[model samples]
Target: MTHDAHSALLHAALDAAERGWHVFPLRPGTKRPALHGEQRCPGTGPCASGHRKWEQRATTDPDRIRATWARAPFNVGIATGPSGLLVVDLDVPKDHSSSDTPDGATTFAALCERAGHAVPATYRTRTASGGEHLYFTAPPGVRLANTARTVAASVDTRAWGGYVVAAGSTTSTGPYEALCGPEAVAVPGWLLSILRPAPKVSEAPSVATMGQSRRYADVALAREAQTVAGAVHGGREAALFRAARALGRFVAWGDLSRHMVEQALQEAGEAAGLTVAECRSTLRSALNWSIAHNQRRRTA
Candidate 1:
């Protein structure tokens, strides 16, 4: 990297730290972890901690950031989950030319269409290889696991257990450029459902312990309903459907009564401006869908 590029990266790292984002160093011009050794690293594989365990050692301490970046112009890696952030990485194929139509762009557009909502305006970064990273504040409760090509081919998630190369980090192709700087937005309900599916039902707890367990379960289910309630917008019906479906899971597990779940959905939907008819229709559809979904899981 050039002296100018090095300065740009260091400045970017500091800025991220100031924003309370946990930042770590990647090997200069590469995505590998800057730290390496037999002891400091832990793992059994070649690309594990011994060489590129970047995610494990990522930190936000200013002193550590300053010391690491000063020794060499290292690329910046942001610890995603630790920072309460999630990133969608839309990537172009490595063999593709920079000017080619980006796969990420095409798939993301399709994703927006399917969700019945436009992408929320927030912080975005243009990657060195002509891809993009859409940043969002991670939702509570669900463990958004990192996955590759799950949303679409070439589209991946850097969730709670992953890291993303920060904007301004330099690579062989070029620097990761910040395209937008707004606060990270919430992940839409449609997107969230795809990233983290509704939990499956489990065997019922003993009847002897039902009283205490039911109280705890009700509180948990109520919180999940609130998560759904937040999904009120252009896709209000779809969002409610997701919420109702989640509630249905509790019913299936015998932790919540169907009447209780329906009451919760009705109240939340009405408060969110949904009509009585719409809420009922959504609830019925969600229950049916949940039943079918569970059947498929059981058979499979």
Candidate 2:
């Protein structure tokens, strides 16, 4: 693609980013200039030659840029938001067949069933080489990596001769499937059933008694939160970022009230390898105790 066309695509992507869409980068192999969707560039890193292309596209043709954004296969609202940019591979071989599905519709239905949601028909797309991209709306408040992993896990795309081309990853040219569309799909009943809420577990009380127990619980919960956040976010920095967000939300509602503590305990239990139901029951008991103590304090 020419510099002008590349700029156009970048501007469109930037606009999409501003609108809450994640602008995933693409490239052929590890070599060649990077491309955001159809927009190709020569930059490297975050502000690489590609970044310059996007900037130029934004400046030279603002209206056309907006139009491109509107029509982009992957719509990212704006260039700035909590969501970060990702670079993914888009090439899949046509002759590559998987045992999962014979055609796009079946693939779409199967993936949706596995993801525990209903996907929009619009999310399905035919690649240049006759492959398909089956887009599905991600769950709200879930990390992108988790969402991606969950989707990947749910579908046997490989058996059907399709595979998820990870963003920033390499691939061989064939038919490609890129899921992209707007619409929030609810979590399906089967998945919801499998993912039962965490249950509570019993812990031996400390010899130091009351204050020590509370402190111990707090420290343990905090550590567990960090671990869950790490796994969900996929890196130390990203994990910390998620933890800060969760902490802020928790504090905003009130600093770990008995009810909050119980909820945290349930989450902590899950993070610590307990079943959701087990964590819930254990935390419920703890919360009841804490509530009784609070009530007594009020009466006194």
Candidate 3:
């Protein structure tokens, strides 16, 4: 990267940090983190006491930001959870096959119209793919989890356990540029109502304690996990995706616990030589699709 490019990215990190957003380094020209994973933890410096994940490693300290960005022209990422942000990601579909589906921007606009409120203007960024990101501040005392397409078709959210590429970062396609406010407005109440998950009524049954009839779910889980674990090297991610989608029906039916199924498949995916990040992304997307499409209600 040129000196100007390096300076631009460094300023981006510093700028995000200036807004009180916890910032971290993404690989140059990529969204992936530049930091080493747990498997490669050196157990020195920041991890001198213990290994801190990227989320934990994210910082708002200017000194730390400058020190880290000095080494390379790394892109900037904002840890949404620590920064108390809830960003709505409006995404465009890839390829021509899914042309019928409306883009996230359209769907979100429709949702806003139906909700009887104009889209609340907030800090907005234009993503590299020509989609928009509307940044919102989380309401105090309310902790929201990241969601995929929960708000509307093609609309996903980032909260805890999620991060967004900040403005000034560049990808092969284009740069993520800020179009609006430096301060993200508070999350609109109407939007929050849709994003929040309903309160749990009862705990899901564990694998060992499942009733005889529900045992089918456990059997299916084991079978799918096996398929994922033993998948061919080239098709491991696809296998993991298929397994997660297949078991999603069981989770949607409430015959299987989502947590249990995720853990099983995650272990299998890792065992099959997939990275933890790869497994999580695929697993989350697949399961979200399955659960949303196949929801089942328990007897009263």
- For each candidate, the alpha-carbon lDDT, in order, equals 0.74, 0.36, 0.84
User: What would the per-residue lDDT of candidate 1 be over residues 169-205, giving only the tens digit for each residue?
Assistant: 8778887889985678887766776567665534434
Pairwise lDDT winner, candidates 1 and 3: 3
What ranking of all candidate models by lDDT puts the best one first? 3, 1, 2
Question: Model 1: runs farther than 4 Å from truth?
Answer: 1-3, 37-53, 93-102, 203-300
Candidate 3 lDDT over residue span 1-300, tens digit each: 789999999999998888999999999999999999999999999999988988899999999999999998999999999999999999998764977888999888865664456788789999999998999999888889998765555799999899999999999989999997757999876677545544342334432334743676777788889998997655676677777877887798777889999999999999998889878877897788778866764432
Q: What lDDT does candidate 2 reach at residue 287? A: 41
Q: After superposition, how far is residue 149 of candidate 3 from its true place, in Å?
A: 1.7
Clashing residue pairs found in predicted model 3: none
- Which predicted model would earn the best lDDT? 3
Best by TM-score: 3
**Per-residue lDDT of candidate 2, residues 1-300 (tens digit):** 344544544554454444444443334332222335334543565445435532122222345445543443321122111232221112233346666424444543543443335544443434444445443333444323222211222232211111233221223443233356543243333332222222222342424455654565466457646564334311222222223333332232233454554465456545645457644543443344334323321110
Report the lDDT of model 3 for residue 19.
Answer: 90
Candidate 3 backbone overlaps, count: 0
Residue pairs in steric clash, candidate 1? none
Model 3 — which ten-residue stretch has the worst lDDT? 199-208
**Better-scoring candidate (TM-score), 1 or 2:** 1
